[model samples]
Structure formats: C-alpha cells, structure tokens
Target: MDVAVEVEDLWFTYPGSTEPTLRGINLRIERGSFTIIAGPSGCGKTTLCRCFNGLIPHFYGGTLRGRVLVNGIDVASRSTHELAREVGMVFQEPEDQLICLSVEREIAFGPENLGLPTEEVKSRVEEALKALRIEHLRDKAPFELSGGEQQKVAIAAALALKPSVLVLDEPTSNLDPVSALELTKALIELNEEGLTVILVEHRLDLVARYADQVVLMDRGAVLVQGDPREALSSEEALRLGVAVPKPIRLFKQLLVHGVKLARPPLTSEELAEGLVEFLGRHRG
Candidate 1:
C-alpha cells in the first residue's frame, strides 16, 4: 500500500490554550483514496488537517510531540514551501486562499512560486482550469466570481501545484445546495483521476456517497476510522452527532418495520434497487 499520509501519537496545543487540540492521534491515508474527517465543532478536524500539510507545528507555535509524514517526508523536518509542493490545501473560504488578481493568476501562483518554467506553469494552469471546468472564468477577477466559482478556482490553484495529496477543510460549508453538489461532483472526478483527497466536512450525505474511508472524531480524539459503510453504521457515529446518510437511516427504519433487506443501503440508488428487489420477491 502506497501511503500518502502517516501520523503517529500526534499532539498539539495553541498558545495560551488550556487543553491540547489533538491527543495521541494515529492515522494513515492511502494514496489515491478519498477520505473524510468528520466531527462536530471543535473536534480537532481542522487542526489535524493543518498538521497533514505541516501547518500546525510549522505555522503555529506550540509544543509538538509525534511524527507526521507526507509522501515519505517528515512534516516536522520539511519547510512549509517544501510541504506545499507535496500537499496542496483548500480552505473552507475561497477568499481566504485567493490572493491573486484573476483566476488564471490564482491557479498559476503555486507553480510560479516554485519557479517552474513559464511554459510548464502555463500548461499546469491550463490543465487545472480545464479539470475544474472553470476555463471560462480564467480572466475574471477572483472577487467577482460566485462562491462556487471561487471554490473551483481555489481547487484549480491547489491542483496547479500537482501535489500528491489534496487536503480540503469544509469546502462546501458556504455554498448553496446546487453549488455544493457541483463541488462534490468535481471532487469525485478528481479522486477518480488518482489524487488522494482528504476532506473535513460536516455534510455526511455528500461525502458518504464517494468517500472510500471515513474518520469520525470527537473531543479531539479519533472515535473511529474505517470503510465508510462500517464506520458510519456503528452506534458511536450516531452518539457523536455525526449525520448519517438518508438512505441508511431509511433502511434502518424499514428494517424496524419488518422489511427484510440483506444489507443497509448507503445511497439513494442502492435503496431504490433494494426496494425493487423486495417488491419483486413479495410479488413472486
């Protein structure tokens, strides 16, 4: 197994904070897998993501214990610039990450900063823009675009770096439902293209549909991490305020109502097919 990220007994604390934000965290992410880190507010999801990109101990000053390796490089030993090339990050708010004047400049900023050849930067910018389907907005000012458009531009900028792993924190928190769906589809497409994606999001339904693994956290500790189906179906997930997909909830309800199904459905499509089979069996 090609490992993209590895953390062992990680611990972190902010200046003047009474309690540590993370405690003895251990996690490993496989290359090319889509994983979601989910928890309620203040559960250290964002803090853990920052560590993945070397933001916690590097950017923030505090006592750090443990090791975080990204693409075989120890995060604590690598500089922020070096880590940025290996792990691209997209924040919850696009405006927070967008510093360039236009979409094209924003996307090209990373490669340019790395001092790549002009042609290479141009090629990467074009590819990133095309991948996100935001070529039409290439010339538009970052401030002038809609929330979804801004997020797409942010993701494009991250992609331009060509990082082995992409870490996104609440990418869909501010978007409308339609925009959220659009962003989710784009993320799924990126994951399909072999980019390792780690997202910290509260929207369970969106991530449940595509996430290969799910990490449920609480009180600055990992509660469970495994295949999304197994982890999300556990009772601990329900007790921690993590939202369950509607299909799974519905399946459980039907099971309680005497409907016999072989497995709990994870998506609407699965639920529909299960219902069809159940009806067919009854008719027979």
Candidate 2:
C-alpha cells in the first residue's frame, strides 16, 4: 500500500509523568490522503502526531515503545532534522514557531538551513508564499500579522522544506471563524495538489467534509478509526465528546424518527441534499 506514515503498537510516556500518554497506537496514513486525528482534550492527539516526526522519544525525552515509520524509514533511527525531509510539523501556536523578523525570512529558514543554493532557497520561499496565499505578507514582520496570517506563515515555513507530509496540530484554535474557513480552504487546495495532510483538530465542522478518514481517540487510545461518516456517526464518539459534525448529528436525529439516509452526510451541503430528497419522497 502507498503509505505515508505507519505506527505499530506504539506506547509513550513523558519524562515525569506516571502514566503513558499514548497507548498501543496502530495507524497507517496513506500517501496524498487527508486525515483528521480528533478527540476530546487530553486524548493523546498531540502526542500521537509528535511520534510521526520523531518528537516523542527524540526531542521530548520520553519513553517510547514499538515503532513509528515515516515514508518507510524508522523515525526512531533518524534524527528530527532527517525526518524533516519527509514530514513538516506545525504546532498549535504560531508564535511558538515564528522566530524570523519578516515573514519572507521565516518561510526561507528551512530551505536555507538545508544549505541549498541561495537561488534555490529564494525559489522555495516564493513558492511557499504563493502556496499559502501569503505573498502579500512576505515583507511584513511576523509580529505585525494577525493570528491567521501568522499561522499561515508558520505553515509556509514548514512547506519550504518540501516535505511529503504536512502535520498540523490544532492550527485553528486561535483564529476567528472567517480566518479559520480561509485557512481550511487553503489546506484543501494543497491537499488536492497531492500533499498528504494529517491534522489534529476538534473543529470537525470545518474539516470533516474534506477528510478521507477520521481517527477518534479517547484517553490515550483510539476510540474509532474509519470513514468520516462511520467514525463521526458512532454513538461512542458522541459519548466520548468528539465534536461530531452538525450535519451528522442532524442525520442521526432523522434516523431516530424512522428516517434513514442512504448515506450519512458529513457536510452541510450533503445534509441539505439528503433532507431535500427525503422531503420530496415523503411529501404527503
């Protein structure tokens, strides 16, 4: 299978914590697919994403067991710098990652560090800027950009590495609705262009429609993993406080009233179509 990332029987614990934060995680992310890792707070979502890029045992100094492979290479055997060639990571807070004075410099940092020729670095910086639609913010200082803009800059910085996989952790937590939607559109555009996207987020409403799969976690273990319709529609997911999308919830209610949709809808548009079809057939 054309897998981008693979985790096997994974377990991990922090340096001082008495308990493991991730437990027996086994997952496979296919290349060029958009996947969402979601659950309630403290469900090990961040910890699991960390494993993909060697942050767990390497940077975090935690006890890690089992195996994590990115692009068929053992993450544990490779340094984080080496893993960066295949996986690009963006944290929850953009401020935590932004260190350059200007947005242009921030995006160029990764390629420049790789010791690429100056012209190559410049070319990558320009491409990254264009990809995220942040070309206008290039010359502006990182501090001057809004929260959404700063987040885009951070993503652009990661993209400059030309990684095959992009991992984002709660990237929309600090943005307003409009900004969040704008960011979501940009990400979808990138995913359509063949970059594998693995996102850790709670806002299912914004991303579920585009996700090829959803993995729901609970208390350091996977609660459900499958199609968005199947995963989000599970009673267990709602009970575990996974933010099942509004459309799924509405369809579930209709199901309770003896109305079954041929296919559960994940987005508002799909839900509307289902509703219209039901109304058309049952108009007494």
Candidate 3:
C-alpha cells in the first residue's frame, strides 16, 4: 500500500506528567484515503495526531519513543515548519488557528510566513479561497464569520501551503448540525480529489460511512483498527464507548433477534436498504 503516515511502536509522555499519553501505537494510513481516528475522550487521539506533524515531542516537549513517519520523512527529524509543507494540521477549535483579520489574509498567512515570493503567496491564497469555495467571504474578518466559515478559512489556510496530507482533530465540535454536515461534505470532496485526510472525530454517524478505514483508540493505545465495518463493529470498540454509528448499533441489536444483514451497515441509507431487501425476500 502507498502509506501517507506510519507509526511504529510509538510512545510519548507529556512534560511534568508521569504516565505516557500514547503507548506502543503502530498504524499505517494509506495515501488518498479518508481515515478516521476515534475513541472516548482522553484516549490520546489528539496527542497521536500531534505526532503526525512533528508537534508531540518537538513543540509540546514530551518524551517520545519509537518512530513516526509522514510522507516517508521521519517526523522527529524535521521541524514543524518543514513538515507544514507536507502535512497541514487543523485543530478542534477553528478560532485557535485563526489570527488574521480578513479571510484572505488568514489563508495567506502560512505561505507568507514560509517566505514564498509575493506572487506565489498571492497565487496560493487565491487557490485556497477557490478550493474552499469561499471567494465571497474574502473581504470579511474571521471574527465576523460563523463557526463553520471560520473552520473553512482555517482549512483554506492549511491548504495554501499545498500540503499532501490534512489532519483534523474534532473540527466539527463547535458547529451546528447543518454546518457540520457541510464541513464533512467539503472534507469528503477534498479526499475524493486524492488528498489524504486523517480526521480525528467522534461523530461516527456523520462520517463513518465515508471513511476508507476506521481506527479505534483507547487508553492511549489503538484498541481496534481496520475497515470501518469491522473496526466500528468490534465488541471491544463498542464496550469502550467508541460511539458506534446509530445505524450500526441498531442492526447489531437486530442480529441478536435473528435478523441478520448480509453485511453490517454503516449509514442510515444502508440500514434502510438492508431492511428493504430483507422484507422483499420474506414476502417473495
């Protein structure tokens, strides 16, 4: 497989803390795949993501062991600035990443800080704005935009660097349902264009069906990881409060009552199809 990010026996501990936050994590995320990293709170999901862009031991000052590679480069070997060219990170809170006054400036900030030529920076800014389809908001200030708009601006800023990978941590936590769905669709569109997306989120109902792979982490380690159907349906994941999508959960209960789907369904649409097929067969 063409791997975008690889973690081998990774371990990390925060400064002034005794217990490690991440423990013996081994994972491989394929190129151009939409992968979701999910689990209960404090399962080290965010910390593990930090390792993807050289933020763990580099910026957070922690004890890091094992190896983490992004786009075939060792994360510990490069500065965050260096990796920013290869991996763009969007945090849980869009406001935390937004500092510029205007939307265009927010998108341009990264390339400008990278010291790209004037025309190159401007070109990148325009490309990012167009990519996110936010050209109409170019003149507005970030503080004036909605939560979803700010998140889009943050993503656009990250894209301005022209990175091959995008890692987001619970990006929809603050948005309304409509905005969250819109953001999710935007990310899906980006992934369809071959950008490797690693989304750290708990809203399985919103994204589980769209992921190529689902990784369930718990207590600072990966408890289950594989195809979404298998990973999210794992008894271990469900027992650990991984928040399996409602459709999947409902079907599991149906199976216990002697109603089995040809396969597990990840979304409501799939669940409905399964039932329809089952009913037709019975009537026939």
Deviating ranges (above 4 Å) for candidate 1 = 276-284
Pairs of residues clashing in candidate 1: none
Give each prediction's root-mean-square deviation over alpha carbons: 1.6, 1.3, 1.3
**TM-score of each predicted structure versus truth:** 0.95, 0.97, 0.97
Q: lDDT by residue for model 3 over 34-116, one digit each (tens)?
A: 99999889989999989999987789998999999998999999999999999999998988889989998888889999999
How accurate locally, in lDDT, is each candidate?
0.90, 0.92, 0.92
Question: Judged by lDDT, which candidate is best?
Answer: 3
Off by over 4 Å in 2: 279-284
Clashes of each: 0, 0, 0
**lDDT score at residue 111, model 1, on the 0-100 scale:** 96
Segments of candidate 3 deviating more than 4 angstroms? 279-284
Of 1 and 2, the candidate ranking higher by TM-score: 2
Tens digit of lDDT per residue, candidate 2, span 1-284? 69999999999999999999999989989999999999888889998988999987899998999999999999999999989989999988989899999999999888988999999999999999999988899899999999999999988999999999999999999999999999989999999999999999888998999999999998898878889999999988889888888899999999989988777898888988998898888899
